[model samples]
Target chain A: MNETGRPQELPMSNPRADRVRDVAKLAGRPARLKRGRFLAEGPQAVREALVLHRERTAAGESGVVHEVFASESCLDRLPELAELADGVALRLANDDVLAAMADTVNPQGIVAVCSFVDVSLESVLDAGPRLIAVMCQVRDPGNAGTVLRAADAAGADAVVLTASSVDIYNPKAVRSTAGSLFHLPVVLGADIGELVAGCKERGIGILAADGYGTLNLDKLQDENAARRLGASAASSAYALEAPTAWLFGNEAQGLSDSELALADHRVAVPVYGSAESLNLGTAATVCLYASARSQQAS
Target chain B: MNETGRPQELPMSNPRADRVRDVAKLAGRPARLKRGRFLAEGPQAVREALVLHRERTAAGESGVVHEVFASESCLDRLPELAELADGVALRLANDDVLAAMADTVNPQGIVAVCSFVDVSLESVLDAGPRLIAVMCQVRDPGNAGTVLRAADAAGADAVVLTASSVDIYNPKAVRSTAGSLFHLPVVLGADIGELVAGCKERGIGILAADGYGTLNLDKLQDENAARRLGASAASSAYALEAPTAWLFGNEAQGLSDSELALADHRVAVPVYGSAESLNLGTAATVCLYASARSQQAS
Candidate 1:
């Protein structure tokens, strides 16, 4: 213990001690996820966020990291720690205290409280995003992260999550993204009406993925196919064009009538098995990949 | 109390009482999952399994359904209950007991303990499965189920899981499958080498999805370009002409060196996101869909 009431150092080499500390923090939901921030543990998540921070610093900009905390023991173990914290604020906290801030029981001995990088529809759209994934009332953090990852892999423009969806910054969600969350601009809390209007203004087609809807995903991906699925509309040269925005809904209840009606088209993945529907994460991946393939083929 | 020494039946019509019983059971993991049998609570899962059972029975074959338990009080509430329970052995277990057998905390007032269905590798391959999914050491039940669901949707022949993987019949895995488990043949507890050899003997190409490995999935799918990936030779026949199997490993240590070497071909999904890697379930889905698309295009 140090004079500052914080442990002067932490030893991360011991897996047992590390797990014990991490479990304690993650056991309590409140301590694990506070109002303004959440924990980002796990080597994959921490490493990705750290790389994003490094990229910003290398470009002569202040790193995006809000704060960096690592077990004293972890500092010695991680050879690149010094490089990651070159111009960023750093902290030495007790392993347990740091674990308490994490969302997983198995902490990676290092975590970063990176503030959410706010992104806008205009900025993301301006980057020539050909494919965008919009999530509606999908509250599962893991599902949200998976969607972000799928969008990134398919080389989509951006991923925008609606207000009712899970928080993109949630530790579990961020980790699930496998670091793709950092590569893509993730926008949270967008009004659906305003979003649809913004896309309309930008001449971007809105495609809603609804389970109960009639449109077939494979059919929609094929432009040569004449019949469109649900909510088909006339193309406005730029609008109703290829490389459009895709909307996905809540896992249980699915997209609301209002949300479905707002789209220019609705599509459903054809099912041969007895499954009533696909998992939200699986469905999103399939849809995003379908659109990406369509655009690529064209 | 019943003379049979079973606890007194609680009225199911009372929402508060039903909720109390349901929560109590979910807290006790053992009560939710036991040897040889597990709970499948959701309507979709319960319905699908029942339908599969019926299809078999209608074909002049017998099926095993231990018991059908439902809320006696709500028998009149949901008119379809009777039709849904089409001639299954029924017992009016108390609402509290039924809750104990439910997988979810909020019981849907429906559950069943069907005999665990086991399939032989001969039967799976005999069906001329063009696509197969193999999990080397996937440890998460949810991930296992999600993979199975994806395999089913993409029209994979079957999913073979090793003993090192989580139990496919685990309640959480079953729920995650959303009824795909019953729709497809899932073989657990198998020798990896034997399974690989068996598939090879059947002229099926085995592809291991390794994140750290060499082959890019996109390039492999590109038929017009160099379709070569992994150590094995690419089949000149279209992807549909060659039966294929995909192997996924544990979340932490991924596929072992030997397992990767055993692959007829190996491919990695192109990643653009910051996520260290995709979650096991998401990765499996992506690979399965890619193969499906390639085969369709070919």
Candidate 2:
């Protein structure tokens, strides 16, 4: 305890520390699912949470951060955490102990246990929805993170992670977000049928990206031309519209038949080479950015 | 050695296997560099070398691959490798020993020792002379690999790495390429000034991607509007039009002024919201794809 009389040390006996530790271990499948909590480690992820918190504050939204843990050495080395947790509880732990809690081989020397940002299908759709990314069964932690990062960068209003996708809480997935997980509404464990239904209820269009599809993205981004094309495509025997949700599927087995049936639009990114397919992450980034560009132009 | 008058196997005294094992141990900096050659392992990476070998064969070019090595298991698993080794010596070793030489946490049960593919600046520029990616001082293997993969998908002629960039042969880097390195020309250890001069010599364009640059990529990709609004800006006064190479710098320090000044064009991918900036890999993907799009329109 310093002059202020508040304990600056890690409360080894504290229930909260125990909880954070428990959550950190839950980075594996069982724990992530059991508690409806996922572990996010590293400085970039935690820093993004702080920024998200600030954005929530500015927007008058409830964005309460649960807990922040740091090595005293980290506290001395980096000021961002102290600044982010100005009024919150910041506990110092052994540097080695803190290092143990980090998922990365090279720890940034800080970690945080955060509550998932809550956003519902209704909220995402009702927010005057336009661009969104629906990630289905993307298994790679790095790939999931990359998609989320791309979604955030492309200004997708929300990212819906289907049940088959890698858990968003995995430390790698969190790190991959490049902190975009905090910038937008990331809805995880969403059901496919319900997601499609929600989008339909909210008048959001659904576009499925297939490398073999007949539609060209460049033509889709043109408002006047797209309006004409989308009119015939949607109104005729086949078509789609703007205010779309782009659906990306599994890395190996792509979008299932049932999932594909839900899309009103089928689009493909052209490839000039012999490679079987672009890695899922790259495909999604290309499509999402294409959609973003189209939306921006219109 | 099996009986039946067979030649003595001598416990499979595989020299290539021994070399792979030695290279794996060299990942520790002192070892890697102490010997001028570094280990490039895994089936995909080896396959990449084989593809390069094929390209060189077709082009009547030579000196692409120095050697190919595999565990008896990999050869059994991929029988096609046997056919690919026209005159190259094939040596088999124990699986466990090969595993020891493997860099990935899970060895693909295959490893190869090959001289790095040496491409003169003239060769790469002459190959397509339209698009290229220049990387400076990028340290992360995965980031480097992902960039290579992206550059490949974007159809860039080659990926040039400065001396400070992570070793292209790093196992993670090799894996990240996801077999793209096989299809693409990757020139490493070239001085940035020389790379710039080579691109200029070939009548190629140059664009340096910087976080602080004011150029909007969307405008750059919009050929019709850009042609009218910024014709000179996109051509003589700014853009390099003959062919083009987009330069990317290290993740942390970004491009130095000297490197940045060497480019004919500088552009930034616009960012909004509270996120700091895109990851190096993501930024490269976005920039490379943008260049591809710009070239397509042109």
Candidate 3:
């Protein structure tokens, strides 16, 4: 180890090396689950992982980034990554080696292997989250990632992917997150029934975003506006400003009747146009942002 | 042609037929432009196109769908399609042939050849649009398609793609629209400057959605709330409830200063969380829905 506690670096010029193959294997769910590691591709995701690792290590927590592989030009482009890599292993890799280690067609010259950093559902709930996004059976990786990005952007305390949901560590999902994966706690493989019960017990209102809900999201926004205007006292009616966890369902089927029954209220984002419905990701964003805006105002 | 004005069809058994190659070539921009036709892949898009064509023809306008190629199973699955093919040519093809003519991994057993239905910028402006989404230099086909879907959902009158933006007919984009492409008019190759000027002449307020805008979208929503409360007069302030065209810039660079200056107001969708920013599609959705809700309430 060097003085900074980072492992000695070696130039990786061979794309067919065993190490490259091992890193590339993280693209598959089976390999990721078996190894408990995943590839964070591109400069943006790699930098975020390194930065988060540094922050966690500084706070006496386990680091997230296992190792970083970057071409010389990539290191030059993102010099701060070197500083962020303190106490970590860094490998100088050739373009082909970096490409082979990444899942993207053009990885922008960097890739990192990171341990699964998802927090336990218990841990996430224990922290008393104000805003949470619970995705149920969201099969599309792009939709899953986009929802995560939206959740992060809305300043949601955490995002929970139900037991049947797509793998958050899927390369497409991770890529869709645009580095937001490293920004907040993501809980995976939680039982929906227990999650609902847990949130109810924790004083968090579990709201289901459904197209057929009797509760209109616009009305919810208006209620918040009424509260903001001091026109009415905050009643027992579901208020978006209150601590809440939004339950979103499968892209195709949406929330089944049983799943919808689990929520405190099923709220529909009002569709004024002739177009049938909003996609899962767009619906999630509008719902999260509605809560976010109301909370900020309150 | 049959008595119903629909072409009598035979089962297209050959995957390598000249007609199949001609349809497959529409996946490329050059062929689509040259032939003035594009492929609308999958059941949803194809169904919507045929329905729209029927509606238009019933209203004494030109039909949109020139022809539809579907597998026997697809036709069996969607029996209503037979009714929709009233005046259009229908060809029964093998699954392999349908797949070859589509851009998707799975084309859902049908593809439709439709003439370019984009209206001129002048026609869009002539309609005196209440809600429009103007995408400037948007390069990602997926983002462009998502915006189209969002606009359609919000009941926007039309969507204008600037001359430099991605081809609205791009196969990936067509797939992303999820059939919203046929729900409304989509204008292509419009000059941004003329659009702004045209919107101005029609008393349509052009609001630029930007990250660095002085106006916050939440505040804009608040203004509508205030208006709804009858606390203030609608004055000269740009109102979401008013006839408006939202101008969205490229995903990466956003609106150049010059472009921002062209709009009456530059508005930012407030970012309340640690996420750097919402993706272009999500941002556009929130903005469009905000306007949609306000307009509907008014």
Candidate 4:
């Protein structure tokens, strides 16, 4: 190991090495599932992964990051990553080798092979989560990641993707999360029906984010704020301060009839202008933030 | 014109034609600027363009749509497009011709050439805009469009892009807007210094969306909601309900010092979790919606 704790021996210079090809294969679903690992690329994601890895290891749990590959110049520029990866399998590689193992043309000169981070739904529900975000059949990787990142920003306890939803471990989805992927617990390939029943058994409210919903999210937020501030005693149909799971649906069709039927209440983020509706990510962010503020404020 | 009011006489079949090349060039800045026109590809954008065109022509103003090209299948599926383009020059074209002229791999079988729709800063100020979103050197086309769409959903009076920002008329930007581009006014090539001065002169509050800002957005919202609900009479440093202009910075580096100095206050969206920060679109949405709710509630 070098003085910086980054390995300086046998730098990976061959882009077509068998090891490099093996790492690159993780970009596909079959490879990722078979190996029980995924790639976390770029500085932000890799840094967060390393932090998580350190925390888990320090706590006597299995680490999340399996191995990390970084360019020498990357380590030189962001030395904290090298320090954070002290006991991990750290390898110095050329940019071409790094790129060959990455999904993006430029992985910002760093990438990490991370163990699957998703926990079982029971594990998340057992923690008594106050706020959760669920995506049902959300097809696009970008949309899926956006919702996950927004959920993290909103302080959501966990995120759940129903069966048939885009894979959170997809390279593009991981990039879109912008490191928030490592910030919170996630449940993937979950059955919406079973998840909803599990939440109900645990006394969690379910809200569906729908454009044509009967309830307005703003009114609920306003009511919650008023109630919290001692302004009014009026009761809202749904309380934003309660432990809740929000269901967000497909980008184009939104929540299907079956999906919408599972929710306790259908809520719409008010659109005060001519826009037909907010995009899935925008709507989901608004809903999550509203719930977060109400629960936190109270 | 046929019975459906579409120009079915001469179907555009040759993708190699000079006219097709000219239309295709609208995807680039030089061609767009030279012709003072841009492409609105796909069903949603073209339909919105036609709606705006009809409204303008009915009011004795010049139409926005110059020409529209569509495949027969697209018009057949969406007959409203035919009715909306009654007074416009609409030509039926084959999918190959349409694809050749479009920037996207799939134009969804329709495209429109529309005049530049940006208005002057003075015009926006004259309209007494209560809410404005200004992008300063934000280079991503998708980010620009997301902000625009969010602003529309929030009922902002206008959106402004300062010098060096991405061109909102870029094809990708237009597609990202999802037809919200036609729902509100936009100003382009704005100088931040002069624009701030103009907004201040019009009694509009200037708020910069900064991560390091001293003000917390949630506190401001809570205070505003409390005051509006007669729960608290406490005053905040900045009134979110007042006529306000929000400045969003570049995706990577954020606002320049000069740009940030122009704002009356730098307000940061409250991060409730471990996320380093929200993405440009998410932050912008939260800010705009907060302002919209505050202003509208009062």
Candidate 5:
């Protein structure tokens, strides 16, 4: 073991080695499912995975990161990863080997093999999440990842991906999350109905973000402010400051009538200009931040 | 002209045709500049370009769209494009021809040759804009496009891209705008110092959206709320409702100290969680929407 108590390793030089191929395979959904692991590419994602793994292992929890393959330059740039080497397997690899093992064209010199980090819906709800982002049938991987990142930035307790949504483990989605995938609990493949029920049982108001909804987001914000100032009674069901779980729908078709009915209120972010609508990622960020701001103010 | 006042056309069946090659060349910056035109791909963009072209021609302004090449199915789906045929050249092309002329893998069966619609900095400033978004040295085409889309949705009168920023005419950037590129005035390649001076002279306060800014966005929103309620004087330079132009910097490096110094106030969107920061698109959306909401309320 090295001074950091991590197993000593020889540098991996072969780009076509079996280990490199195996790591690369995790980029696909079937390979990830079969191996029970996914590749977190780039320095930010790998560092986050390693840090979380160390914290979880210290807390006597199952470690998420199994192995980290980094180029010499990446290791030199991030000396903090050295301390994390004690709990996780760290391997130095040639730039070509690291590139071969990564999904992105430019993997930023580091990649980590992490076990599936998605938590169960029941667990996420049981923790009494104050703010949650529920993506229903969101197909685009980039949008899904951006929503996850937005939710994390807004301080949401968790993100719930409906069964029909894109796989959270998709490499593009993982890379898009930037490191927030490791920062927060993301519950995937949860049934929307069950998730809504759980949120309702936990006193979480479910708000649907739709472009054609009756409830106006600006008006809701005003109402939230009024309620906070004690100028109005807390009678409105669409209060933005309430413990909320925002339900965002598909990219192209948006939420179906049945899906919109599931929410306490279907809220529309006011379109002040001639642009048709905000894209899924931008809309979700506005909605999530609205709730975050209101909750913080209250 | 056809019976619907649309130009009668024989379908161009060959993907290797010179016309198809010429349209495809607009995807590059040099070719676009040489031709004084850019390609707007997909049905949505083409349709918007045609609509804008019709409006501009009616107003005796320079036509924005020179020609639209669409597959039979696309023309059938969007019958409204037929009316635009009288003002702009409308050609029917085979699927392969349309695909060859597009930058995206699937061009959604339509593409338009659009004249450079970006106005001069002086023209944008002369309009006496209310809300505007200024991207400084933003290298990513997608980020630039998204910022434009967000600015348009927020009812911003214009968007200004600094000289060092990515080419707004990039195919990926145009695709990211989702037709908003045709909705508002976008001024490209402006000198940042000159743009700042112009905004200041026009009574437009410049706000820099930075992660480390001392002025908190939430507090600014609160002050705007107080101003709306007549509880606080509207003397604060950081007021959200003011006629303002938000300056966003590059994706990785953010704003330099010199760039931040040009802004009247450096505003940070409060990060409620541990996620390091919001992405460029999301951050711009929040900042723009905050201004939109405040302006509407006041």
Candidate 6:
């Protein structure tokens, strides 16, 4: 950047340039892992990355966004993105270069190379999180992102994905997050056993979202509401208002038997109709929102 | 004449035959509309079709499933599917035939051609539905299917799709329903204006899921719970326990102005954190489950 904080170089026009290829390579898992960077495509994701980058840099910390590439029209369309990317490496690229640098066909004309945003599990646990969402062996990138976005909406303190779960850095997963990927701290390669143990030590209750679990989620919510309303003493299985960590399992097979056993209680989101079960993302959203409401109300 | 109730014809092994092509055409909307039939692929969907077919056939009504096709290995693996197709035209086919006749590259070895199952909105209202889910211009087949599946899971009495919406009969949408499509009554090509008027006349309330609405869903749920627990009067703009139809709008733009205006109330799912708004499916699921819980508790 020059003294005026404007891009110093000419607009990148070559789609097959080595720099474009390098940026596009972040779409692959191996490249992402090797460089500790991932692609944040589209205006929403790119804007969020830039915002986080600016905030971190302002706070005297390393920024999340490494570099941003955008078409001239995208910059003209979303001027705030340029403002947000103040000190970051924001370079102009033609549509072809932007497209070639992005995993998404459109990328809506902007893509950012973001540093691996996941933090250590210990760091997340140290924050004394009141609510956490964990994905166990969730293979689908879209499902993983949906759950992450839901977790963010639920005001989850953090989100964790086990080693067996899909890599959240996948471009599809990043797009699926709809910018929520930049909103919360994430911990990858987490071991469920350690997380369970950590939460137990922190007085954080663990609930497994199981289809066949004995505890009905509605019953639990009703009990929580009853308690809040000062109803007569009822035998409560678990308190929804308490600090909690929810374990969401795979898209197909839910939490394995061992994973279910790790939780303080197995809670079933009551299936009132003939659906064999709720999809993973839907179930996680319901569970997180239920807990978020209960905790927030208290 | 053979008195036994069984498919008298030999297994259909030809993939390129006119009959095979006709069956495959159901994957397209025009063919499906012309024939009034759609394909249900995979064991789960086909099994549900067969079960519904058997039930309808036994009840002195026309069956849903017109013809059943399966590979030998599929029937061998899922013997119950064969039994379910006892009275239906069950034709054994090679995997090649199954693949060619299915939209999915792999149809899981079984497919069923079923008649259009949508009923009129009047009939749905006539049945005294306590909870109905309506999708307004929800173009994505997968999102529509997700909401339908969620509605079914919430035990909603019916689901409705406005004329501007995607055809729920799209194979992808049907698959997304995960067999929930056959569980409850569905009304297609509904006019939102007419639906609102009819629902009002029938005393079924309408709630549009709007992110910018003044009504908070959690507060409404809490109020409903409080009333059930005998709390003093809190002026609730609406009663969630009342017979209701929830209108979920387009995924990207949400409910249009006119669509939102047709509702008795516009309700917002609270975003506890940084997420701008919940996805259509997640919001719909939360709203439906909230109403289901309140109604069931009452």
Q: Identify the leading candidate in terms of lDDT.
A: 4
- The per-residue C-alpha lDDT of model 3 at residue B192 equals 88
Q: After superposition, how far is residue B277 of candidate 5 from its true place, in Å?
A: 0.8
- TM-score of predicted structure 2: 0.83
lDDT of each residue in B1-298, candidate 2, tens digit only: 1222222243244436656557566455566556544455777667667777777878987745555556665766776765565555555656666666666655666666665564676677667668888899889988888888888877777889988788877767777787776777778888888888877877777788988876767666654335433333344244323367889989888889998889776788765334567778777877877766556655
The digit string of per-residue lDDT tens for model 6 on A21-69 reads 9998998999988999999999999888887787778899888998888
lDDT of each: 0.69, 0.70, 0.88, 0.94, 0.88, 0.91
Give per-residue CA lDDT, model 6, range B1-298, as digits (tens): 0243334466677889998999999989999999999999999999888878878889998889998888877877887787777778788888889998999999999999999999999899999899999999999999999999999999999999999899999999999999999999999999999999999999999999999988989989999999998964787889999999999999999999999889989999999999988988889989999999999999
* Candidate 1 Cα deviation (angstroms), residue A286: 1.4
| Interface RMSD per candidate | 8.6, 5.0, 1.1, 0.7, 1.2, 0.7
In the range A186-220, model 2's lDDT, one tens digit per residue, is 78888888988888888778888877666766455
Question: Which pairs, if any, clash in model 4?
Answer: none
- DockQ preference between candidates 2 and 6, better one: 6
Tens digits of per-residue lDDT, candidate 5, A79-171, equal 777677666778888889988988888898888899999989998889988899999999999999999999999999999999879998999
What lDDT tens digits, residue by residue, belong to model 1 across residues B41-94?
A: 655676676776787778876664545666665454654554656677555555
A87-201: candidate 3 lDDT, tens digit per residue: 7778889899888888887888888899998999999999999999999999999999999999998999999999989999999999999999999999999999989989989
Weakest 10 consecutive residues of candidate 1 chain B by summed lDDT:
B223-232
Task: DockQ for every model, please.
Answer: 0.34, 0.27, 0.76, 0.86, 0.79, 0.85
Q: List clashing residue pairs in candidate 5.
A: none
lDDT score, candidate 2, position A275:
43
Candidate 6: residue B275 lDDT (0-100): 92
Best by TM-score: 4
Interface RMSD of 4: 0.7
Q: Give per-residue lDDT, candidate 1, residue A60.
A: 92
Judge candidate 3 at residue A87 and give its lDDT.
70
Best of the candidates, DockQ: 4
